[model samples]
Target: MKTNRGGGDEALKFSSFFFMPERPRDYLVLFIRFSVIACLVVSVSLVLRATFLSSSPRDYSTTYGLRFTTVPQKSIALSPTGSIGPLNVSHILFCIAGAAETWIDRSQYTSLWWRNSTTRGFVWLDKPVNLPQNHSDVRFSIPIRVSDPGWTRFKFSSSRAAVRIARIIWDSYRLNLPDVRWFVMGDDDTVFFTENLVKVLSKYDHEQMWYIGGNSESVEQDVMHAYDMAFGGGGFAISHPLAARLANAMDGCLQRYFYFYGSDQRIAACVSEIGVPFTEERGFHQLDIKGDPYVYLSAHPLTPLVSLHHLVYLDPMFPNKNPIESLQNLMKPYSLDQNRILQQINCHEGKRQWSISISWGYSIQIYSYFLTAKELTTPLQTFKTWRSSSDGPFVFNTRSLPPDPCQRPVTYFMDGAEDVRFYGTKTRYSVADKNFGLCENNTEHSELTKVKRILVTSMKMDPEYWNKAPRRQCCEVMEGGRGKRKENEMLIRIRKCKSSERI
Candidate 1:
């Protein structure tokens, strides 16, 4: 009985050690499942937290507003008769008041508003506290100095003018202003289209963009070429950091260039010297208020945005109806190609020459020529031929022989204008500054010979339809002339040449 009991006990021990009823296994599986579920819950919580943080707006806010000022240099008579006194002061006051009213009215509906306008009492004047002097944060004040009757005569030299403007802007900064992002300085003559401007500013990354303006000058080029950096004083913005830099640089700049002439130029020079990154937006202009279809602004188109300048020409009733409007209206119903041609040609009554000058990239020269109107019209055919021809050394003839490739057709209203001098030359031939004797030649003659060949080839073609013929005729004539014609005949043939060849 004792042996049997002992064996039973051993058997019981072995069963307990090797195969307990799967309860432990169940417990172990449960633990693993619970652990996995806990991990998933934690992971989900973390993901939610991260997403919330990533999507939340920053704690600070950006303040934006328009700042306007005016500088009148001289007075001029408004009417043809000199009986009336100079209207300069009245004109400036009118502009200042208009700008003020417009901004005040617009601000009621928009978040951005002007601090001071003629309609609204000057509230910016109340603030006189100083703030940090750091590069990213600055503060100063501007005293209203235009209280005199002839304030129009108060010409603050460019340097003083810059300082005065800078002081006012610096002083206007709200003390410890949180996240003050940008300050836009504009002339009193400017009218801000806040909605459009805000929409544009929202699209750009403010951190990367600095010194935003209607125009900008390349620092290197402006300094090297002594060209003005395009700071359209009419409308410009500076980021907080740039403003700090400007404040610091102002004194040194004034000392260096004591007699600066152009306000925009001086600002650009200072910014360039300080190595600030600058950007320009298109819709800004300095001189004209006419809105161009292809441009955002009339005179200086910034990047892709459009802004107008010289608000004096802006019609209150028809804001966009100046020259640009007229052109746009005339071409509005036309096809794209027709519109393009019109734009290229300035098809308006007083703007024919305007069109050709822009197309030829000779605006100044064309303007000068246009002033000589009768002489200009006399060369209409010559200009037309020049416009039509692709290659040069244009030729003309007084007495016609074979049709001249260089000969341009002329239309004259005046009678007895036979033997119109059509100018043509082989474009390849460089005009030698040295006087050409009857048979002068030099060691560099080979270059001239090559050019002459190219010119001859360009102008070779049948005379009957010189302007309408294929370009290959020119090549044929140059390569396969029948024989040497008389000098006079060659000259006459050149004179009768027309411009029909395709490029």
Candidate 2:
């Protein structure tokens, strides 16, 4: 089922502000985390955006020369009642790729949103599926075909992509009909944010000859042969004109590069030869970045976050993908605000001052702050009362009163007064310096208590409100209880509390 791992052309050479390793697969995790901060041959000023807000139509026309007659917008909002807002999401046609074995894992998460007809769908498989009599809708299924009977047979490695993937390009292109303006293609495990996908596509004209794709292996994949071949796994869009042209030219192109092994790179070759360049959108992630994508997807930057690739190896998208409880009940009212999430969104390292990364998975670290975090271990019998100190009794509560586990912000309670100053260009940025999230004292409640509460936010609670949140209270336990603390790894083992009341 994991066959057709794609490949890229004569590796796109570069001499700019960015550097991608020749063997990216080996170091994808390190590359994704550090690349954003370290490898910038020419770091283009990142256009910081707030979540849920739409940006003005971006003009990629001059660079890629891919614009056409008209470009619509993709920012739609849901009204107060949770119904459809101004934007109609059905404009997208989702083309999902997977073998018979992986189809369930890939399509089930997205199935939550696929019932809507305006947003049509198709599952591209190696062979036709036999649907149950009770489930007789053929609208979401497409069996790929190749004149060569053996074209679809390939291993789950990148070496065979060039030859096997031509069938996908053609099969996907065949679905580029007039009814839908955009055609999006992705592997089985890809999740499409219909709302964001629409928002992104609306920026470009559907009639134009455009290949709305993402990075192959570097920043600004727009360089020469790199021309932004859609990373097929993260999901890519094709305007009708561009898709039609690709489908029309696919046969001859396939014959020309018959021995090529990477499907995506080969497609890029065809598109490059035909003159439709790929325009990258940051939101479409194409790699198995950090293991837990909860934070990445939950509070992504202001850009319309579109897709997350390689979910087969991580925890469920949400432990409770669909929580029975309402989000309003579990989350703060402000969780609905799009601007705050985008505005406070940041990533940094605590090299100089000390920073703490709230992590859920190998790479899915959430909040990165200048504050240093220390584990405060105390014996239940030996400890008497809680008092404020440079040290903290921050409680990691898998029990009561905490929002979502992912929502927990790494915090440090200073002795007398802690003034936060965000500097150091690479690892930190202050609120005054154009960034999202608030790094200030917790004054919302009666903070003048036994212990003071300072809130460090990543704007993650809102999305997790509806699902199961980690009720584990650490900082909140100390702040909510009595506290004493210190810095960095002290590594003193304290026995786990057998009962809540050991005082």
Candidate 3:
């Protein structure tokens, strides 16, 4: 009975050992598993927090709206050359009226308005002043001028003008109850294309970029060359921060320098000093006496933005004759009176024998062509083909003179072989016979032979054939085989010769 009881107790002890954990090792294993799971959960939480929850904040105070305004000098008298005689007032009035119309049209897209002060008998003030209400984003600020006679000098004029415009711009910002992103300074004669300007500005939203009117070129100090900086009086735009900087800069300058070259140069110098760079756009161009004026026009067909100091009036009589007149004639189709406008500007009665000189590239040979036709005629019928020596010149076999007395004399030289190389002597033509000398003692003959040899070699004829080939035949061969192997071989030989000579 004792042995059987002992066996049952042993069996019970063995079963308990199998079912329960009795060692420290087992507890340590369980603790390590729970610790690893807890560590993984903590690491995942930290990663999510860093990636999705904790990010740098964004700025919300930056301005987005843009405003445009014109700054006209009312206190200062017009330049001596600015006079249009009896039509001075009429011209100024017409410019103001045209500007007003453009402003009204542009106001549809953004805030467009005139920024000027009251002056004595200024025709610009006489125009209808109605600010558009539809553009909630746009507003106008026409500040009253506080006349100060002492502020009439070049430096003072620019500084004071900047201050006044800046104040008006700031006031507009306050009244409109919105943050203004950009402020554009333009001329009264400028016709703004608000849509295009807006499209261009949208590209550089956060970047503080200045869009200067006209082409900007680096000029030397001593040279009295045409100003290449952004003409503030013509058209230019400044970012919100830049506008503030400019205003502050101007104010600082007003307290110091009393002599500078007006507002445009002053602004240019000031901005340059501050290390603020400008981005140029063709949207703003100076109305000039050269180039295609219509290409510079912001509002196509009729109105051009920012007619500089020169192109204030359109000459009616010589509409297509001169720069200003040509611009007027080009805009005639869009003007109110087609024929009467020209007559009003004295287009029909003018008999002035104006000298017209046509320039061919960088050459000095100015071909003078006169027109006896009625003034304002485009003279499309009298058009002359532009010839260049590099472009293989104009070939005129017949020695017929042009109808106009002012036309330059073009003497046609012929090669009896009918393989003549026609060149325009117009560029290098000398009016003085003394400048040209006849071939003396066969010096030109040697040169002619050398040129002929070069021509034969360039034509890539066999060495034997080139030695005996006629000049006309060589020329004929070259003309026929333009893009052939002969042309390439000739080019290669020329390059090799030049390189060898250099070496």
Considering TM-score, which of the candidate structures 1 and 2 is the better prediction for this target?
2
lDDT of 1 by residue, 447-491 (tens): 222221112111222222212421211111122233442211111
**The candidate that achieves the highest lDDT relative to the unseen native structure:** 2
Better of 2 and 3 by lDDT: 2
Predicted candidate 3 versus true structure: per-residue lDDT over 313-422, tens digit per residue: 32221212553343433232212212111111001111222221111111011112233322211212111222111211111111222344334321111111111134
Flag regions of model 3 displaced more than 4 Å. Answer: 1-163, 166-182, 198-211, 215-226, 239-241, 257-262, 277-283, 288-312, 315-503
Off by over 4 Å in 2: 1-88, 131-165, 172-176, 216-227, 290-301, 315-503
What order do you get sorting by TM-score, best first? 2, 3, 1
Reference-based TM-score, model 2 = 0.46
Q: How many Å off is the CA of 80 in candidate 3? A: 45
List candidate 1 stretches off by more than 4 Å.
1-161, 172-182, 195-205, 212-226, 247-266, 277-282, 288-503
Taking the tens digit of each residue's C-alpha lDDT, what string does model 2 give over 224-319?
234446777778887766666676666666667655555666677888887877788867766433233333333333354576565554433434
**Clashing residue pairs in candidate 3 (N, C-alpha, C atoms within 3 angstroms):** 190-306, 191-305, 317-347, 319-325
Candidate 2 accuracy as lDDT: 0.42
